[model samples]
Target: MSRQIIKDFVYYFSKPLPFNLLRKLTGENFIFPFYHLVADNTPIHIKNLYPAISVEHFKNDLEFLLKNYHPATINDVLAFVENGKKSEKPLFFLSFDDGMRECYDVIFPILKQKGLQSAFFINPAFVDNKTLFYKHKISLIIEALKVTKENFLVSELMVFLDIFSANNKQIIETISRFKYSDTSKIDKIGKILKIDFESYLKKEKPYLTLSQVLEMQDNGFIIGSHSNDHPKFREISEFEMQNQLGQSFNYLNKNIHPQILSFAFPFSDINVPFSFFQFLDTKIKIELSFGTSGIKKDVLPKHIHRVPMEDNLKNATRIIRSEYAYFLLKSIFRKNTINRQ
Candidate 1:
C-alpha cells in the first residue's frame, strides 16, 4: 500500500486514543500548527489547491488547542528555544501562510475574541494584491476551463499546453505541475483561457494588504517573510535562494519593521542544505525559520518544522492525533527527526 494509505489506516485505528493522551505519548511538548486560510466559502484562487478550513472548524481547533495546550507567542517560542522555558501544559504556536485577505476579514476577529496570538507569513511580491502567485494563476485558469464549453477553445488550450490529446483531468494535472519558473507559461494559459488575473486581483483583493499586515502586527500578531514570491526553494539555486530571502527580509524591515525576523519556507524545507541555515545565522540573523514537515524535529536548533493542519480535509483533532501517531511510527525506524545535508 502507498505511504499515505498506510498513514490513513493508522489514523483510522488510532482515533480511539484520547487527544490529550495521544499528545503525551508523542513526548513532544511544543507543536506548531499552520494553515493557508480559513473561509466560510472557498475562494477560486485556493479552491483547486486544497480544502480551506471552514470558520467553524477553525474555531473548534482553537477551542481544542486552548483546552489542551497553552497558546504560545513568538516571544514564548524564542524563550523556549533560547532558555528551555517550560510550561505546565504543552505549548502550541499557530500561524497562517499566504497572507490571505480572510486573515483580516474573517480570522482576526475570531482570534481576537478568543484572546490568542499567532504569526502571519507573507510574500513581499504578492502583498497589496500587486501580483498573484503563479499557483493561483493555474487555479484561475482551471476554473475558467471548467465553465468553457467551446470545443475550439479547449483544443487550442490543449495545443498550447502541448497536451493536445489530453482530457480535462490531464490538462489540470499538467497545469498544476507548472513550476515557479513556468510563470510565463501560466500567463499564456491565462491568456488562452481569457482569465485576467489582474482583474481578479483587483476585484477579489485576495491577499492581505500592507495596511492589514501592519494592523495585525500592531495587535500583537507576529509578521514574517514567506520568501519574495513563494518559490519552491529546492528548485532554485543557492544564489536565487539568498536573493529571495534578502529581498523579502529587506521588504519586511523597510515596510513592516517587525521586531522579530522570522520566515517559513514557501513550499517546504526538504533538501535545503545545512550551509543555508549557517548563511541565515551569519547574514540574515533570522530569529526563527519554519518548514511544513509535520510533527518532526530538525537538526538545526533554530529551524523548526510545523504541522500542516489542512491535510486530508481533517480537523485539528484528527490531524494532531494522526501526526502524533505518525511520529511514533517513524520513531521506531529512527526517521522522525529531519537532518539537513
Candidate 2:
C-alpha cells in the first residue's frame, strides 16, 4: 500500500530485462542499457506519489546510457547476426518508445552532445496533431464517470476493470499473462476506458511534440515507427497487424519521416510470431525491429536487444545494482561462452 512496496512491486515484476535465467545458461552477462531505463519526465498521474527525480541525475543517466550503452546503428545488429563477431562495446540501444516530450528537453541534448546514436520509436497518432485514440477515449469516459472532489481518486483499480463488464477476470488474466517492453496494458486500458490517446496527450501537460522529432533527427538520432494505432500483436489479426504496422509506417513516414529505418512491435511477446516481422524487415528499410524476448546476441549489422526500463522503483540507481541484477547477470559472466547468440 505504501510507496516502498509499490517500488518493490515494480522491480520484482519487471525482470528478464535486467536479470534472467541466461546467467545460468551462458555464464556471460551482458549489460542491458535498455532494461529498466529511467524516463526523463514525470508522468502527471504518478508525480504526486514519488519523490522528484533529480533533473541532474536524469541528465547523467542519459549521458551514461549513450556512452556506456547503445549500438552504433542497425548495422550493429546485422553484424551480430552475420559475423557473430562480438562488438567490443556492450550492445545497448537507447530507445524511448513513446516519444515523450521530455526526450526533447532532457534526453536529446545529451545525445547530441556525445555524438551518440539512439532510436525514437514514435506513435504518429499522437504527433503534433491531436487525434482521439481508444485508450484516451476510455480515460475521458471514466474520468467523467467518477464523482470526485480531489484532483485524483484512488479506486480499487479493480473497479476500473468492471467498467467494460466484459469478463474482468479474463481480461485481467489476459493482460497479466502478457509481458512486453512498453506500457501495453496502460494504453490498452486507456483505450478500453474510452480515453482518446491523442486528445489525452493534448489534455496531459507533457508529450512528445512533433518539433521534438525534427530536432532529434537534426541532431543525428534515428527516428522509427511505434505503430499507427497501438495494438497488441498477440490479440490482433494479420489484417490488423498489417494495418497496425502499416499505420506506423504510413504516419511516421508521411508525417514525421519516410525513411524511418525501424519498427517496434507494440507489446511484442511470447504469443506473437517472428513472421510478423518478415514483411516489414524484408521490404521496407526497417532494418531494425525491437521486441523483449528472443534476443541473446551482440550488436550486429541488424536490430538489437533493449532492456525496457519502467517506473516501478524509487531509487533509479538500484536498477543497475539490485540483488536481482547482480545475481542474474553475475551468473552470466561466470559462464565461459558469451551467449551473444
Candidate 3:
C-alpha cells in the first residue's frame, strides 16, 4: 500500500540474502510494507552514498550468481535476436563506470565467479593506476564557486582537477557567476584552463589495462566507453560532445573491439533531452545505455538506470516500492495544492 515495500525490495536485491531463504528463516518476506525508500544524496555521491560491503559479502553474491544465474557474451546475447524479436526478459545488463580499480580488484572476482557478464565503462583519460586527484580538487573548487547547492557533473571532479589546480580553482571561483555560455567568456576560461591534458591523465589509475579490460571481455564483460576526460555531455556543445564521444569510441576500438555498440552519457541527468538521445539512437544500435533515473516505461529510449549496491544496505525501504513512495512523500512535504486535489 505504501512505498516502503519497494525500498525494502531494492535493499534486498543488493544483498546475498536469498529471498526464499529469508522467507523460510522467517515466515514474513518483508518487514516494511508501507515505508518508501529514497536513495539518499545527489548523483555527486554516487558510490559513497551506498553502504560499503566487505570482501566476503561481495564474494558470496558472486558465488550465488555463478551457481544460479545465466550469463552470456555480446554474441550470445544478440543470439536472442530473430530477424526482429525482443527477448522475454528485458536484457539483464550489469555495467560499472569510472573503472574504479576496485571494480578491477573487487567487482571482477564476483563477475568472474558467476561468469555473469557486464559492461565496464572507463574514461580513457584516467587510465593511470592512481587516484584522479584533479576530480576531487575541482569539486572543492566548484563548491566554492557555486551560489547554490547544485547538482554536479560528478565524475569529472577528479578528472578536471588533473589539469586545473588550486591556481585555476581560484579563478573559477571568482568568475563563476559570470555567464559561462558566452563565447568570449568560454574562450577566456578555456585559455586559462588549458593544460597538457594527456600529461595529467598519467597521474590517475589507468582504467583496466588493455589486458585487464580484455580479460573481462574474455570473461564476457562488455567493455564500453565513458568519453575522453569524462565531462558531462549535457553541459557541453554539440561539437564538444562529438569530439568526446568520437575519441572515446575511436580509442577503445583501436585497443580492443569489445562492442563499440553501447554508449552511456557522462554524468547522466533528466535534463539530457530526448532529441539529444535521438542523436545517439539513430546512429548506432546501442543495445543498452545508463543514466540516473530509475527504470520505467516512460523513460524508455533512455533505457538503463543504475542504483548502487550500498543504498540497499543503508535503507531496507529501497527494495519495497520505496521509489514510488519517495515521490509521494516528497510531494506531500512540499505543501502543494496537489495534495488537496
The candidate maximizing TM-score is: 1
> Which of the predicted structures, 1 or 3, would earn the higher TM-score when compared with the native?
1
Q: Which tens-of-lDDT digit does each residue in 1-341 have in candidate 1?
A: 77567677779778888877877887787899999898988999998888888988998988888888888877789986775433445999999998899999998888878878999999999999999999888888888777788778789988887886678889988888999999998998888777888899999999999999999899999999999999999999988999999999999999999889999999899887788888888899998999998888877878888999988578788788778888878888999877877
Residue 219 lDDT (model 2): 70
For lDDT, candidate 2 versus 3, the one ahead is 2
lDDT of 3 by residue, 1-341 (tens): 54446445545453565534433332221111111112222222123223345566545433433343344455544443321223333233456776655667667886677665667787776555433423433433343344333224222332443434444345454444333234344333333344222343454433456677777777767777777766666667767776776777777878878654666666564455655566566754466556544322223433444444344553322332243333333445652111100
Give all TM-scores, in the order shown: 0.96, 0.63, 0.56
TM-score of 1: 0.96
Which sections of candidate 2 miss by over 4 Å?
1-32, 35-41, 45-54, 63-78, 132-147, 150-200, 203-205, 258-260, 294-303, 314-317, 320-341
| lDDT (Cα, tens digit) per residue for candidate 2, span 239-339 | 67777777677767676673446776665533555565556667565766666532234332454444445445433345443423433443456522223
- Whichever of 1 and 3 has more lDDT, that candidate is 1
Candidate 1 collision pairs: none
Q: Best candidate, lDDT-wise? A: 1
Model 1 regions lying over 4 Å from their true place: 83-88
